[model samples]
Target: MGKHVVCKVSELPPGERKIVTLERRSIGIFNIENSYYALKNVCPHYKAPLCKGVVTGMTLPSKPKEFNWGREGEILRCPWHGWEFDIKTGKSIFDPHKCFVKSYEVTVEEESESVETFEVTVELGAVVVHI
Candidate 1:
């Protein structure tokens, strides 16, 4: 496994995502509530560019005639098939146990730490994806 820097922390604000190619693998790096998460860009079903889909919330379980929405900016909606996935876990909403996208561990590295580790000068912090 290796760490690949995706972008500066400032580049991807809260509720934003950036798709990058690291080690010839296309991965989607997301910033949800100040935390970073990485998912494979390819959709598990049809090989669509999953990162290009919309980021949205899910409808929570509620009593009849009531609607509850939660996990805003944490659900990824597939552009082609309308399949929803949890951005944090890359799991499908319908079949979480069997169907899911590939996910990677993400981290935010301080400029000083990156300078020493990667020998690169950064202004603030960098988003890193481990693969």
Candidate 2:
């Protein structure tokens, strides 16, 4: 696995995401509810930077055909057309079978002794895309 130091854990704030370019690939690193996740920054629909989108809990209709909605967990919504995706799995809630975003492997290292010691590494997993 290729491990790249994208940013320090302290650089990211909870419920926020940032775009980082590595090897010509745009990467989105997010800190949600104290956990970290990384994905391709570009929206698959139109290549818009997903990092520019808002991060919020997944919204689902209350019933099969109801207008009411409910919250699911950390999801990223594309600002361009409101395409929603589960940040944890990179899956589109609208289309479970065919939509997804490229996800990266993230490692958070916290010190057992010190409360402030921490490190984070972002890596591309088995799915490799050349920029």
Candidate 3:
């Protein structure tokens, strides 16, 4: 497994995401409250651009005639079929165990922790994605 330097932490602030191509594959790198997460850009259902979809929360289970919204900014809704997924785990809102999208590991690397081979703006911390 190799680490790909996607972008600087300053570039992608909290509640923001960036779609990057690494090894010819499109991947979405998201920053949620300063924590970085990476997910495959393609959606499992109908193969929509999952990363390009809306980054919002989901409606939780509520009683009859009641409405509740939770997980703010942690959900990704597919634009094509409106399929919702958990950005953190890349799991579908409905069938999380069986149906899901691929997720990658992300880490924030400081200048002192990075190697010389990888070129990134480690001074401000860089988002390194592993695939």
Candidate 4:
């Protein structure tokens, strides 16, 4: 597929997400820890807006009857089925192959053309996601 401009780099802040309609398809663009990831809005398990689901990390149990919480805002839970999927890899934690959402390649293009910071010039651009 071709590349499309979803939104500005500043528009989607960290720990937030945006649903974009492109090529007659709905895609969920997420910004996690300044990193961006794109995932098909449709859940492979079922036709659901997977992007609109909960944005929280998973729980790992240290042992039986014990639970450990880590990696906050790095996981997404389906709203309808509660299926957990890694936002970065788009792979289902429980069922890697059988269940998964399509992940798209996302890229960020800064808005500014060029800038000098402490004797260093950097080019700031916007966010352009390639599916």
Which residue ranges in model 2 land beyond 4 Å of their true spot?
Answer: 61-73, 110-131
lDDT of 3: 0.91
Q: 56 in model 2: Cα distance from truth in Å?
A: 1.9
Better of 2 and 3 by TM-score: 3
Model 3: per-residue lDDT, tens digit, 7-72? 888999999999999988899999999999999999987888999999999889999999999999
What are the TM-scores, per candidate, against the unseen true structure?
0.84, 0.71, 0.82, 0.79
List model 4 lDDT by residue over 15-73, tens digit each.
Answer: 99999898988999999999999999987777878899999987876988888999789
lDDT of 2 at 128: 41
lDDT of each: 0.89, 0.77, 0.91, 0.87
lDDT by residue for model 1 (11-129), tens: 99998889989888999999998999999998888999998999999899999999999999999988889888999999999999999999999988876554333444545687554
Give candidate 2's error at residue 119 in angstroms: 24
Task: Please give the RMSD to the true structure for each candidate, in Å.
Answer: 9.1, 10.5, 9.2, 9.8
Give lDDT: candidate 4, residue 92: 90
RMSD, model 3, all Cα superposed? Answer: 9.2
Best by TM-score: 1
Candidate 4 matches the true fold with a TM-score of 0.79
For model 4, the superposed segments whose C-alpha errors exceed 4 Å read: 112-131
Q: Give the candidates in order of TM-score, highest first.
A: 1, 3, 4, 2
What is the alpha-carbon lDDT for the whole of candidate 1? Answer: 0.89
- In candidate 3, position 11 carries an lDDT of 97
Over 1-131, each residue of candidate 2 has an lDDT whose tens digit, in order, gives 36677766788878767788877888888888778888888888998887678777644546676664444338889989989888877888789579989888888875355454445545665544343
Quote model 1's TM-score.
0.84
Indicate the residue-level lDDT of 41 in model 4.
93
